[model samples]
Target: MASQAPSRVGKTLIALIKIGLYLFVLALVALVVAVSVAVSQLPSYQELVRRDDLGQMIRVRAADGSVIHSMGPSFGEWLSHDEIPAIMRDAMIAVEDRRFHYHPGVDPIGIARGIWVGWTRDDRVRGVSTIAQQLARNIFLTNDRSMGRKIREGILALALERRFSKEQVLELYLNRVYFGGGAYGIDAASRRFFGHSATELNAGQAAIIAGLVKAPSNYSPTADAEAARARANIVLQLMVREGAISEAQARAANPQQVEFVRTAERHNSARYFTDWVLPQLETLIDETVQPIDVWTTLDVGLQRAADEALNANAPSAQAQGALVSLDRDGAVRALVGGRDYVDSIYNRATQATRQPGSAFKLFVYLAALETGYTPTSTVVDEPVTINGWSPRNDNGRYQGPVSLRAALALSINTVAVRIAQDVGTRTVADMAQRFGITTRVDTNPSMALGTSEVRLIDLTRAYASVAQRGVAVVPYGIRRVTTADGTLLYQHRSDESRVLVAPWVAAQMTDLLQAAVMTGTGRAAQLGRPTAGKTGTTSSNKDGWFVGFSSGLTTGVWYGRDDNRALPGLAGGRAPARAFHQYMARAVANRPVENFEIEVALPDWQVEPDAESWYGAPDDYQLVDPDGNPIQPVEDGPPPPPQPREPGSATTEELNQEWLDHAIGRNRAPQAVPQERRGPPPDRGPPPRRQQQEVMPPLPGQRQSAPPVVRPTETPPPTIRPRAPGTAE
Candidate 1:
């Protein structure tokens, strides 16, 4: 029985051995078939080497040729294997793949070690991909975890090893890897992180860049410098172990001391200007033109100045501000869309349309000037009603009669409406459009008060046209566009500037604006030079604006809450004007003092009354005695037949005092006196009827009558100065 049991066990052992041999043969056949299929489905490695799949890139440069921004994947110039620094190559290989030179596509030792560690630890497996395999996966394969993708990756890696030299494969890997911040390739990464080309990278910078390959965002210096530095120290130790650098060199390499070129926060404002300019690029050049260089008109210095000014003068935490600066030819030199572009990228300068307030009066006054109204033309500033809507002055009180220049300078709402009424609102709307206001302007009476919405950029450009002396200005940002190789794709060619207003009219308007900045509401915007601008305050202080020009530069500033809520106590002459002053003070510090060509003469009606003359009488004439009694003349012949006074002939002192009274809130109507006296009241039969006299002809669309008062007793009559040839008195 024992012999029979031994025979049975031997027979069973032999059958199990035959079964194991058949199973091994079957598995080997399946493995060979899978390898063959993966190889057959592999993409062309030659195409991957060329790297033609990278999308287009756009580089925006400032006027001084400094790179302001870059969009899309940024790649540095392709470097040959010899041009790459030896230290950089060694740092990368020591950290990424230590056996890169010895491995032929697949490293069996590395794979075995990775599998053993993963099995023993019972954790996620670590990658054992060599440089060639990584390159193949990046170029020709998806990152799927399926066995099919790994099979394809291994096959392509083997093909690359057979076709290219080891140095060529390493070069390809260095150029194809991403190091964060939109940079691809070692050269770009070096420039992005260190602000220099790869040729200038030292040991510490090379270590930092090499460490980024493991997890770019996690080790990005810009995002977390401490973590990146710690990772780089590991790479430095690896380099020392690989004999690429001595231990003393590794110890001396201070990755913590490495300074980044610029943080994202430092260049965020430039992004606002570039964002505004980028949309215009597509319209300026062909869409298919890949890798373009847009040379914009932005002056980085001026842009920084503007940013500083806005930050310093922004009214409150809730209040936002925008600024737009343009050359006389309408090149956008600086544009700040908001107080903080990171918080909101709405681009208030070029995109948001808000009521410009009294700033739109520039167009209305320009229209009036073109319609034959001189700066000294007479206009009534009393309360005016149009279609049941009455516009009031900033101060509740009104200056009864003011010159066009003073009216505009003071931003008198009723005066603007009256002038618009005389010139026709359509003319004002057309004038605004001609001056480069792109938004639609309402033709209602309130349009003169700038109730229509307008972009800050368009308003600034409109003022620029006036600064250019009647020449039309089309605002532009891009000065030139070129390909990556400096081939010109598009260049801005200014067309012959069309004449929007007569030069003399522009000069007259400029004179009015100068008066605004010199002695009126825009006084805060004065740069101690010949400045021309206007102050604008909307209803309830919802918006404030200051658009002005000096030294051949026109800048406009706006301050308001983004939610359209009123800023308590906000006015155009306040924060906006101060910001304008601060920005212009820095922007034109180096520019030579330039003066506007103000050739228009003041109207005869605006002539100052002689200091010695009493009641506008001749020097020899006398009206009253020092005791307040009328001095009867020796021989007065019917008072010399009542001389006619010119329109708007109020003495300069009286007009100035009236303006002062209105500004100081002292413009109250005279109080009626009681008939009762301290002693006995004098008995009066009746009040005498008021006598009227025709003093001057009516203004363009309204009448003017002298206030009924007793004339000077027996004094020489006032003389009439002949009006100028083209005067609108």
Candidate 2:
């Protein structure tokens, strides 16, 4: 019986031992899997922790070409502990970990004590960390304090202490920490927090800073004060327990003396400007290296002027709006993305896809002129509907049988819509597309009333083509980018190649736009200098836009909310226009006060007949004297015809009257004519036409319908232009 009992006990022991072995193997496998997943899930070190480099955009003065925004080496003027005061170091120790000097990085004894208190005594002191441990976490680990990461962090912390001395580690940690409000490093923190050198610190201020180290957000001066005070008191007690301070001394410390960075001025109205400028760098680099300097073209003085003007002008009796200022080549000089970017980062200028209102009439008029329709071509500005879309003028009343110039100047939506139908929205959109307008425009007849959504960037860029008289320079923010070591990374140069449209067509559009600003809704955007621009008010007063160009500067403004909520009393002619004028007036003050360079791009006509005369180009044209002397064509073919007129219509009377001044006899003015619409691509299913006649525009970048009127080749072209600066081009 005794022998049997001994064997039974041994069997039981063997079974329990096998079970323990199985559990250990399962735990090890689980740990390996978790480690693999964590490492894989982490972002690249360059993007998260080990990243030291951020490109600093360098802003240069347009006149002097001096770099401004930020100097190279964004870690500018950082100091070591020798340069930092001993009091500052002591303060950090006081707030963070009093035993920092006495212990290695791991502090296992403290951790053991923490476990006892947390598990047995039910106290929350489970985080038995030293300053080095905190630094290790900050520089390497994430804020997540999971058990697995904590184990890894301990291993890493021990390795770090072995590699670096206490002082070296402290210096790195101090120099790399962030203290709210976009500030990094102790030097910036001190300057921002105390408004003084790190060498100058009182006990109370030191205590306040020390308190912030525990839980930065919790003890942040920006958050709650009572919580910060309570945390600071806890840190004070720790200092006393560590013998670094007497109880009396700890009691003497109060947070009241911790004066915050005395100025809230750093985050001033420039947030919107910076937000707009930052995104222009996506294609500027291949891989992240040292900090790259991006020299911007913003004039800070002009930026401030623009911001001040917008706020004062927007509330005009009862309106809210936004503003943007740009250089002549379309480099945004200054922008109020919204009243405040934090209020909303959706930049109204670049992101808002709002209806352009009657401001779209500029494109209609330009299309007419490009197709040989003159400013004197008359149209009735009556209430009109196409399909089911009805459009009206700015005021409900329409002026009948008016010249193109009069209809555009008065911003008659019905007249513009009629003209768009005649010339085709495709034609106007094509002209606009050639001028750098990337928005997908609508082909509906209401498109003439600006039913299509347009971004301020595209609108301003398009307008710049008119100012350039033919060539449009695409708007760019960063002009040049260079590495921290002064190696050139990328540089942007303005391309002046003409994409489409003749210089004459640009001139005509400019002339019409000039008329709009000089005696229309855009009058508010008029700078005292020679300028041309247009004003746009969207539905329900949701967006107010003003875009214009001086002889040397072009700018645009739009005001709206991120929620797509209507802004009360907002209109293109009110605050947005006023801000436009304010920014341009100051922006161009330093520019040369000369008119924009303008010239007609005429195609050299030819009259040469091909072999067999199967197709001799009939485009041969010649210059003739008013007395009827013929000038030979550049290429020989056919004789110039007598002035041609549109078929019977009231527009003929206005056309002949305007052309009479330029022609000797039998003169005819250009008239707007309708273009055919191209249907959908072959093999694609067409939905019910009754459900949809034409597709509305998608988002900003998608393609819809191509503009009908293609660009003209070089030839004997007539030039049109906005006469002066105040002209509503």
Clashing pairs in 1: none
Model 2, span 161-211: residue lDDT tens: 565678866766666665553445666555656677655766666666666
> Model 2, residue 219: displacement in angstroms?
1.3
Tens digits of per-residue lDDT, candidate 1, 539-620, equal 8888999999999999999999989998887899999999999999999989999988987432222133221121223545
Clashes of 1: 0
What would the C-alpha RMSD of candidate 2 be, to one decimal place?
14.5
State in Å the error of residue 419, model 2.
Answer: 3.7
Ten residues in sequence with the least summed lDDT for candidate 1: 673-682
Q: How high is the lDDT of residue 650 in model 1?
A: 29
TM-score of each: 0.75, 0.66
Q: Mind sharing the TM-score for model 1?
A: 0.75
Candidate 1 residues lying further than 4 Å off, grouped into runs, are: 1-52, 123-125, 240-249, 254-267, 287-289, 600-729
